[model samples]
Target: MLVDLFDFALPPERIALRPAAPRDTARMLVVTPDALADRIVRDLPSQLRRGDLLVFNDTRVIPAQLEGTRGDARIGATLHKREGPRRWRAFVRNARRLRDGDLIDFGAGVAAAARDRADDGSWALEFAGDEPVELLLERAGRMPLPPYIAGKRATDARDADDYQTMFANEPGAVAAPTAALHFTPDLLAALAAAGVDHATLTLHVGAGTFLPVKADDTADHRMHAEWGRIDAATAERLNTVRAAGGRVIAVGTTSLRLIESAAGDDGVIRPFEGDTAIFITPGYRFRGIDGLMTNFHLPRSTLFMLVSALMGLERMQAAYAHAITRDYRFYSYGDASLLLP
Candidate 1:
């Protein structure tokens, strides 16, 4: 399908620069197969049945943005994937100034050598020293905020906590699973009391999620791979939920994609580990998840395409139109939507 088909006009003011005061206070637009309702995140537990399970992505956001100097040229990089304990694949801003084997010096004694460059213009960088790359990043890196929000204002200390979800534990992701940011301890207790069971998986969301679709057609777009894991126990538990005739509700697109990647043609989810570059588009049949809770996405973005595939293209367009008119927020720090089709 033409990528232009997913395009929609969004007013700049509708983009949220900051999250709601109480995370659960964010607005949630529920789009069922036959109806649309306006609600808040705190109202989620009541939106579904007792036996339904909500799958959350437990991957934590890492400080992936870095600034350095290479041969007197200022360079910026956002680490998107881990190649090894000390090696990473990153998208560089001053990439033309870098070459294979060239060393770039990030301030505070941190440095890395560019090992290789991909056809897509990303660089393979291997950090210097053996103090654990995570430690090096802690000293030289900054939060990798989505460009939509960062472009409008500078990222600050508040974003350090706001960009992460309550379920964050395993560290690797460069980007936050925005939809899960609406969750809080109070909300979790309420959901449990409401009889909504929850589970967790890991998908290290990469900076690729913020990349724009340059392809004219959906078939030409190639999704960048992200690491994810689902243990045998979790898979069995999810299968059990399905067997008991309960719905599996994915908390974010990250969780939805990972679960779908682990599901078989027979719709049974199995233990999975490693990378997934699953690109969901219209006409794709979903097998693992019954519903999704995600943030409002960018125009012509892959996320919008995925939601369009979940619901219908026309229905999502209408849903978005309603959201816009009602003054709901948009993007990573924005409001959310509950999509059930």
Candidate 2:
């Protein structure tokens, strides 16, 4: 399909620069097959059934944005993927100034040697340190905010907490699963009291999620691989939910993609531990999840394509139109959308 088909006009003011206070206060636009309703994220319990399970991505966001210098040239790097304990694949801001084998010095003695440059323009970076690379990042890195928000303002101490979800534990992700940011402890307790069971999976979201789809067609767009894991116990529990005739509600696109990647043709989810570069587009059949809760996405983005695939393209287009007209927020620090097809 033509990528232009997913394009929509969004007013710049509608993009949220900051998240709603009391997280759950964010507006949620519920898009169902037959109806569209405006609701609050706190009203999730009333929207879902008792037996339904909400799967959340537990991958924690790491401080991955680094600004440094090599000689006189200023360089910026955002680590996208972990190649080894000390090696990472990063997208460079000023690629023209760096070369393979160039030593870029990130202040505080944190530096890395640029290795192979991939065809996509990202460079393989090998960090120099005996201490864990996580420690090095703590000293030199800042939270990797989505460019939509970061471009408008600088990342601050507030974003350190705002960009992460309450379920964040296993650290690796460069980006937070934005949809899950609406959840809070009070919301979780309310959900449990409302009989909504929840589970967790890990998908280390990379900076690739912020990349624009420059392709003219959906077929030409390539998705970056992200590491994810689903344990046997969790898979068995999810299967049991399906067996009991309960719906599996994915809390974010990250969770949805990982679960779908683990599901078989027969629709049974199995234990999985590896990388997934699953690119969901229209005409794709979903097997694992019954519904999705995610943030409003960018125009012509892979995430919009995923939602278009979940619901029909026309329906999502209409839904987005309604969202825009209703003054709902957009992007990572934006409002939420509950999509059920």
Candidate 3:
């Protein structure tokens, strides 16, 4: 498949900068091979059968976008990945000018130094503190919102809470697991009342997920690696659900990728933890999930490609056109879709 085959046009107004006032009120596009239906997110349980399991990624979004001054250099950085408590992989501006042994002060007596290089043109910055890196970032950094949103001048006040999912717990991801964001505590209780069971997994979303396929051909586009894990207990629970003939519905691409990467047709999820660079495109048979709950994506993105794989390319392209015509929201903090394959 060629990367350009997934292309489509979207109006700028269709991008949603903020979520709906009531989270569950967001629209849901229901895509089955034979029919394309639409409904509100609150109607999820009715849309899904009773014997379906929704798998969600509980990785919390960190305030990983940080700013500091390297002696008037005025640097900006995002803690892209963790190396050690004292070390981190960060993307910095004016990177070519920066060399080993450059000190950047955060203006609060704490600082970091550019130590080395990681792949993808990222830098290794070592921080000064006994506190864990997560805690340090929590106090120092700002919410790493995507570049498209521009109303907010500073990422301080509302973003700290709004950018995270209601069920956020495991602290690692720089980006939110968007599908989980639509579910409120009240909505979960309602879904449970309607006989749906929820299981949690962790896949620390990395910078790679947002990268466009630079290669002309899909086969040549290198997949970006992100760290993920599924525990023994969660694996057992999933197996039990499968044995009972229930369907597994992944809540986001992150969860879907990790679940599919960890389990095969044997139908047992083993305890697996590590980096996964799995590139899923059309004609790739899905090994784990039967349903997917996800947000609408950018044109020609890896996410769009993943959607093309789930609901055939023809169906997906039509769906995107339909979404545009009906003025559905696009990208993170946008509307969602429930896919049954």
Candidate 4:
């Protein structure tokens, strides 16, 4: 299929700059194969049955954005995937200007020094501190806000809370599993009371999650790799749920991708601890995940393509059209949708 098929017009006004007050009070759009229901996230439990299992991605967003200059070229960079504690793969604004052997310095008081660029146009930066590089990123790095938002102005401290999931734990991700952003502890407790079971898997979301589908033919597209892990215990729990005929409801595309990547054709899941570049698109049969809970994504992005795989491309396009018409918010801190294939 052509990537352009997923294109649609989303009003700039619908792109939310901030999160909703009290979090879980945000809107939810539930779509079954036959019907579509508009509801609030607080009413999520009311939509679930007794035996479904909810799997969430618990990887937290780190302070991945860095502001510095390459000689006279001012650039904004987002540290995406970590190659090591000190080395990482990053996306910068003026990627061409920052050549190999060039040093881009962040302002004073920060303990860091930039290194030469890799052949791929990414920097190989190292830090100067007694603490670990991860620890330093927590202290000196800024929120890795998306380009759409950063274009408006600089990212502030407010994004410390806004650009993360409520269940954020293992920090390495440059981006949040946004569907989990609407969840609050109270709402999760409410789901538990309603007999919904929760499971967690870790998929460190990379800056690649923000990459657009540049290929004209979708089959030609290459997926970006990101670190993901499903421990033996979590896999066993999910497999047990499946044996009991329970639905596997993935909370985000990250979880859905990781679960499907780790499961066998028979739908049995096993422990997985490594990087995966599983690109999901339409026509792929789901080995796991009966339904998905995710935020609205970019028009021609890979995320939208994954949603197309679960729900039909035509159907998903209709849904996006509906969302646009209804003034539904789009992207990271936006409202969510529950899709049943």
Q: 250 in model 2: Cα distance from truth in Å?
A: 0.4
Q: What is the TM-score of each candidate against the true structure?
A: 0.99, 0.99, 0.95, 0.94
Q: Least lDDT summed over 10 consecutive residues: which range in candidate 1?
A: 99-108
Q: Which digits, one per residue and each the tens of the lDDT, describe model 4 over residues 1-341? A: 88888888898999988878789988888877777788889999999878889999999988888777767878767888888777777877777676555666665434344566655566656665566777667656788888777777678878888888878999899988989999999999999999998999999998888877778988998887999999999999998887888889999999999999998898788899999999888888898778999999998899999998999988888888888888888888788999987
Whole-model lDDT values for every prediction: 0.96, 0.95, 0.84, 0.84
Tens-digit lDDT track of model 3 for 1-341: 98999999999899888887688999999999988888889999898777678899989998877778876578888776777768878888767767788987765555888987666678889998677767777677878887666443446577777788877898888888998889998888888888788999999887666666778988888876788889999888887888888888999999999998998777567778998888889988887788899999988888889989999999999988988899899778889999898
Ranking under lDDT, best-scoring first? Answer: 1, 2, 4, 3
Off by over 4 Å in 1: none
| Prediction-by-prediction clash tally | 0, 0, 0, 0
Which ranges in model 3 have alpha carbons more than 4 Å from their true place?
A: 150-156
- Residue 176 C-alpha lDDT in model 1: 99
Q: Which pairs clash in model 2?
A: none
Select the stronger candidate by lDDT from 2 and 4.
Answer: 2
What is the number of residue pairs that collide in model 1?
Answer: 0
Better of 3 and 4 by TM-score: 3
Q: Which stretches of candidate 2 lie over 4 Å from their true place?
A: none
Shift in Å, residue 251, candidate 3:
0.4
Q: How good is model 1 by TM-score?
A: 0.99
